[model samples]
Target: MKIEIAEHKKLAHSMELDVRWGDMDAMGHVNNAVYFRYMESVRVEWMRAVGCEPSPKGQGPVIVNAFCNFYRQLEYPARLLLKLYVSDPARTTFETWTTIERLDQPGVLAAAGGATVIWVDFPAQKAVPLPDWMRALVL
Candidate 1:
């Protein structure tokens, strides 16, 4: 998706990831599934950076929607710089954009993606409105 970094919700969090050899696929590049994990790492970190504690049982945000666009091949043993910024937050859901780039090539983006996650009431197995305290963090 086309996102202007300046237009994001202004919460910024960064993380460094070491690509493991096993993270590569037979095609000789980082596996697509690994990208999701990378993104998840950033999301969790962002929430922590904003001072939101994990749910009591350790369950966190639920992914209601997600998509990624691969711009370049990411190989193993490389350092990935991940940045996450909130996009928008509704009463029950929030969105964020994540960008992963090789540290060696800061300006060259390897992948870009975003996810929409909904707060959930686990026991009820249904969506729940974000609590006021949680919404305060994003705002």
Candidate 2:
């Protein structure tokens, strides 16, 4: 399904990454699955930056759902600027959205996507209320 970034979404993070040759498929474009990886990379980076990295013995964010919409083909040898946004913070979950654009062609969307991230207690294998700090950041 296509993910939409709402107008109220807060811009949480952004970063640039190079598209590797290995990310291309037989069609000579970046593989569809690679787009998800691009989204994941930025998500993880943002989480880490906010000191929310998952812990095996503690609580952290877990992606319960994810999606992307490819607007244009992405090719290797390009620098991508991925901007992530967060919104709709609930007791146990929040939403993250990302827009991927090529630096050489600024403001052109190559892909856009996001995930429904729920805070979870790993040891208990269940959802938990978002931490106050996390909620503040997402709000």
Candidate 3:
């Protein structure tokens, strides 16, 4: 979803995450790793929301790359709205971008990240074409 970042529209399957005490680091704010976890969780949630799940035998989504930028610190007792979207779709992979907005702060961009996910045949240990159904949901 494109956040209120200068007119970009938000996707439909966004999610909210409650910041927990354990999620903070020694710096007294949310840790860097926690943001990635949030993106991963939201990606999984997006998959389920669309009623698509990878089979244990083969077809599944794998993130080959990822990164997050911390625009602001997330203190304890915060709620974040996260959204994910797919771009640069290709035969075997797609780029999933995520944004986190601090709801309490209003329009504050807490973080943004993206992961390159490639569909794969686990048993074959190689890349495979993205299923048409999955592509449909992403597009």
Candidate 4:
């Protein structure tokens, strides 16, 4: 499915993270691993916005594949604005898009990327078709 950011109502989601001294390497900026945490925040917020409860039982969307592109640097005590949206859902997977931007500069996007996640049956530990309720929400 294709998600158009312009068509959806803009929702605000943010996560405040403390910059651990260890987060900085020789370059003195947050390590690459931290970006993944930012992405996680966005995903959690997006799930909440769609009124989907996170399945503690693991019978929910599973990240079959994911990737991220970093455009800039982030420092200590940084507040990140995670903008997210859901695209179309396939038989077993759903597409999602996200952008991490600096709250201080609203127009400057720090990173942008997308992911493909598959719905799964935790009991069976296997991929499953998208639920009707999830498809309805995306549409």
Candidate 5:
């Protein structure tokens, strides 16, 4: 059950991640839990790259939900190329999708996932409308 990525969609960000030895599990493949960490790294990096850093007293994005589908087992000593995309921007939320592929394997998909991101007022702990600049980026 691999997630489909649109062929014509523009990617939000792309980065490489090294699969560390510690990421392996007793079964000798990358642990399922570590995939979520990979997704988080890319998401946070994209947010920072776009100047969307969270401020304790200001508004920022929160991931209300997230999911991932694994199509292939990832082993250690691998470099993964992760591509991220953003879409469906609403007043306070947007969707972030990601594809993980091993650089050594090129086009082969290792996994895919996404998260529903909501803009939140940190102090108020409530949702807020996304800033114009941020909305424009996703659009």
Candidate 6:
């Protein structure tokens, strides 16, 4: 069964993850590219939670823009707590914000960024307005 948006919506969706050795660069800090992977992981998890999956036959979400900023060096063996929220919903796209914090340090921010996600019909290769369910998930 399809679930509607919660009456009382949460500000954001979050999860905790561990920094992997492979995610680091020769400099011993998390590589610049790895932050995006972390964000992608969170987004994919959210999609599953909200019952949206990418399929060629129907409308699926795609990231049209992605960005991140490093506040500090993220090393392996550290715990990362990440949060995601939506802002500025448009007809075919919405902005998603992400906050990456080091769980061990509590309030210390490791990085932050967001992406503009566009809903599209894969077979037609064009954009489509956000579906009701998808809007609910973002809001």
What's the number of clashes in each of the models?
A: 0, 0, 1, 1, 0, 0
Q: How does model 4 score by TM-score?
A: 0.78
- How do the residues 13-109 of candidate 6 rate in per-residue lDDT, one tens digit apiece? 7898899999999999999999999998887787788788788898899999999988888999999988777766689998887778888787677
User: How much lDDT does each candidate structure score?
Assistant: 0.82, 0.93, 0.82, 0.70, 0.90, 0.82
Q: Evaluate candidate 1 by giving its C-alpha RMSD to the native, one decimal.
A: 2.5
- Scored by lDDT, model 2 comes in at 0.93
Q: Would you estimate the TM-scores of all the predictions?
A: 0.87, 0.95, 0.89, 0.78, 0.94, 0.90
Candidate numbers sorted by lDDT from highest down:
2, 5, 6, 1, 3, 4
lDDT of 3 by residue, 19-91 (tens): 9999999989999999999999888898888876778786888889999987888888988888887766689
RMSD of 2: 2.4
* Model 4 C-alpha lDDT per residue in residues 14-119, reported as the tens digit of each score: 4444456666768888777777766777787667766777565756887777777777787765666677666667888877767777678675766767678788
| Model 2 weakest lDDT span, ten residues long | 1-10
Compared with the true structure, what per-residue lDDT tens digits does model 1 show for residues 111-135? 9888998888776677778888777
Worst 10 residues of 5 by lDDT: 1-10
**Model 5 accuracy (lDDT, Cα):** 0.90
Of the pair 1 and 5, which is ahead by lDDT? 5
> Of the candidates shown, which would achieve the greatest lDDT relative to the real structure?
2
**Model 6, poorest ten-residue lDDT window?**
1-10
Predictions: Cα RMSD each = 2.5, 2.4, 2.7, 4.2, 1.7, 6.6
The C-alpha stretches of model 2 lying farther than 4 A from their native spots are 1-5
